[model samples]
Target: MIPVLFLSTVLIWGTTWLAIALQAGPVPVLVSVFYRFALAGILFLFILAVTGRLRLPKREHQVWLVAQALCLFSLNFICFYHAVHYIPSGLESLIFSLSTIFNALNARIFYGERISGKVILASLLGISGLVLLFGRDILDADASGTLTGVGLAMLGTLFFSLGNMVSRRNSREGISPVFANAWAMSYGAIVLMLLIILTGTPLIAPPDATYLGALLYLAAIGSIVGFSTYLILVARIGSARAAYATVLFPIIALGLSTVFEGYVWHWTGFVGLGLALLGNIVIFAPSRRPRRTAPIAKDAETVASS
Candidate 1:
C-alpha cells in the first residue's frame, strides 16, 4: 500500500505542473485555481460524508483549520500558478523541492525541536544547488523572470512548510488528515471565491477542451487523490520517511519538461540536482541515539503514552 500510494502520488503530482500550464489561456489564474479547489472540495466532502467519515472540528481546532486552508490550499498554489508564467514548471518544481528543508526549519521553530547540524548543512547545500542550477541566469541582466519565479516559488514553499506544521497540530489533536483536508479544501475554495469577489476579477468558463481537461485533472487527481495519498503516507511512515517521495518529484517533472517543453540542461544542472537531492538525503536521514539501559524502558513507555 505504501508503495502504491507513493507511486500514485508521484505520478499524479509530477504531471500536474503541465496541467497547470495548460490552464494558462484566457482564464485568470485565480479563477482557474478556484475551479480546481471548488470541484475537489465539493467532491471530497460528498465522498467523505457518504462514507460516514466526516469529522467536524471544535471551535478551537477550526482556527487551525482555517490557517491550514490559507497556507496549503490558497496562498501557496496562487504563488505557484503565477510563478509558472515566469519560469519552466520543472524549475518551479526544483524550487519546491526545498520544502523538505523549510519543513525541518519550521519544525524547529514551532515545536521546539533542536536544530541539528544536518538541517543547517541541508540549507546550505540546497542554496548552493540553486545557485549552480541557475548558474548563468543569476548573472544575466535580463533574468528578472527567472529571479521572480524563484522568489515566488520560495514564498510558496514557505507557506507549504507552515501548512505542514499546522497539519501536525491537527494530527496531534486526534483529527484525521483526510477529514481536516476535506474541510480545509472547502474553506480554501471559499477563501478564493471571496478574493475573486473582492478583486472584481472577471468570471469566465473554460474556453476550450484543454482548459476543461486540465481543470478536471487538477481538481480530481492532483488535489483530491494526490493530497489524500500523500498525507496518508505522512501518517504511516512518519514525515521524514514520506518526504522521500518529494525528492523524486523534481526529477520526474524535469524529465517531462525536457521532453514536452524543450527545456535545456547542462552539466551544472545535473550537478545541482545531485547536490539538492543529497541535501534532502542528509536532512531526512534517521537520527542516531544511544541504546537505552533496561532501567529506562518503563520510563520510555510512560513518556510515549503520556
Candidate 2:
C-alpha cells in the first residue's frame, strides 16, 4: 500500500510540472489557479456527497483547514506557477524537492519530531546535488530571472511544508484527508477568487485546447488524486518520510523535460541525480533495530507464573 501511494504520487506530481508550464500563457495565473481548485473542489464534494463521506468539519478543525488552504492550495501554487516562468519545469521541480528537508525541519519544530542524523546528511547531499545541477545556470551572466525563480520556488516549498504540518495536525484529530482537502481546496479557490477580484485580473478562459486540457488534468489527477494519496501517506507514515516523494519525482520531471522541452543533460547532471537519489535512500533506509518498549514487570511475572 505504501509503495502504491508513493509511486502514484511521484508519477502524478512529476507529470504535473509540465502541465503547470502549459497553464502559463493567455489565462491569468491566479484565474487558472482558481479554475483548478474550483473544479476539483466541486468534484471532491460531489464524490463525497454521493459516497456519504462528506461531513462538516468541527469548529476546532476549521481553523487548521483554512490554514492548509492558504498554504497548500493558494500561495504555494501561485508561487510555483509564476516561478516556472523563470525556470525550466524540471529545474523548478528540483527546487520544489527541497520540501523534503523543509518538511523534516518543520516537523521537528511543530510536532517535536526527531531529525535523525541520516535525514540531516541526506538533506545536505540533496542540496549539494541541486547546486551541481544548477551550477552552470547560476553562473550565467543574466541569471537574475533564475534567482527570482529559485526564491519563489523556495517560498512555495516553505508554504507546502507548513501545510503538511497543518495536515498532520488534522489527521491526529481524526479528520478524513479527503474531506479536509475538499474544504481546503474550496477555501483556497475562494481566496484566489477574491484576489482576482481585488487585482481586477480578467476572469477570461483561454480557448486553447492545451491550456484547458492541462487545467483539467491538474484539477482531477494532480489536485484531487495526488493530494489525497499524499496526505494519506502523511497520516500513515510521517510527513518527513512522505515528503521523500519529492526527491524521487524530480527525476521523472527531468526525463519529461528532456523529451518535451529539449532539456540537455550534462554528465554533472547525471551525477547530481544519482546523489539526490542516494540521499533519499539514506533517509529511508530502515534502522538496524526497533526502539525498545518499556519493560513491564507484571507481564514478566505473569509469564513466569504460567
Candidate 3:
C-alpha cells in the first residue's frame, strides 16, 4: 500500500510538470491556473461532500484559509506557470525541490521553531547544486528569460513553503487538510475569477485539444488524486519517508522534459541534480540520538554491598 501510494504520487506529480508545459500556448497564465484549480476545487468539494467530510472552517480560520488560497493556489501557481514559459519543466521541478528547506525556515520564523544545522547544510547543498545547473545561463548576458524563470520558480517555492506553514497550523487546530483544502481551493478559484474580472481578461475555452487534455489531467489527476494519495501516504509511513517522493519525482519530470521539450542537459546539471536530491534526503533523514546509559539501581547496589 505504501509503495502504491508512493509510486502513484511521484508519477502524478512528476507528470504534472509536463502538463503545465503543454498548457503554455494561447491562454493567459492566470486563466489557465484558474481553470486548473477551479475544476479541481469543485471536485474536491464534491468528494468531501460525498464522503461526509466537508466541514467549513470557522470565521477566524477563514482568514488563514484565504491566505492559504493566495499563497498555495493563486500566486504560487502564477509564478510556476509563468516560469515554465522560460525554462524546462524538469528544471522548475528541481528548483521547487527546495520547498522542504523553505518550509523549515518559514516554520522557524513563524512559530519560533529551532532549525537544525543539518537543515542549513542541506540548504547549502541544494542551492549550490542549483548554481551549478544554471551557472552558464546566469553568466550569459542574453539569458534574461532564464534568470526571470529562476527567480519566479524560487518565489513560487517560497509561497509554497508559506502555504505549508498555514497548513501546519490548520492541522494542529484539528482541521482536516481535506476539509481546509476544499475551502481554500474554492476561495482560490473565486479570487482568480475576481482577478480576471478586474483585469478585464477575456475568458476563452481551452484553445486546443492538448491544452484541454492537460487542464483536465492537472485538475483531476495532478491536483485532486495526487494530493489525496500523498496525504494518505504521509499518514501511513510518516512525513519523513513520504518526503522521499519529492526527491524521486523531479527525476521523472526531467526525463519527460528531455523527451517532450528537447531539454539539453549539460554534464554539470547531472551533478547538480544529485546534490539537490542529496540535500533533501539529508533534511528528512532520521537524526541519530545518543543513547544514555542507565544508572545502577539502589537495590542492586545495596545487595552487592551487603
Best by TM-score: 2
Clashing residue pair totals per candidate (backbone < 3 A): 0, 0, 0
Candidate 3 stretches greater than 4 Å from native: 1-9, 86-91, 130-142, 145-150, 228-248, 262-266, 296-306
Per-residue lDDT of 185-273 in model 2, one digit per residue for the tens? 99999999999999999998766899889989999999999999999999998888898888777777778888998878998888888
Instruction: List the RMSD of every prediction in angstroms.
Output: 5.9, 3.5, 3.5
Model 1: runs farther than 4 Å from truth?
1-7, 87-91, 119-148, 236-245, 276-306
Model 3 local distance difference test score:
0.77
- Pick out the ten consecutive residues of candidate 2 with the lowest summed lDDT: 135-144
Q: List the residue pairs that clash in candidate 1.
A: none
Question: What Cα-based lDDT does every candidate model obtain?
Answer: 0.80, 0.86, 0.77
203-262 per-residue lDDT for model 3 (tens digits):
888988999899999998998888767656544543334544655677677678679767
Q: Tell me the lDDT of candidate 1.
A: 0.80
Candidate 3 TM-score, C-alpha based: 0.83
> Which tens-of-lDDT digit does each residue in 143-237 have in candidate 1?
66878888898899899878878888888888888888898999999999999999999999999999899899999999988888887776666
TM-score versus the correct structure, for each prediction = 0.82, 0.90, 0.83
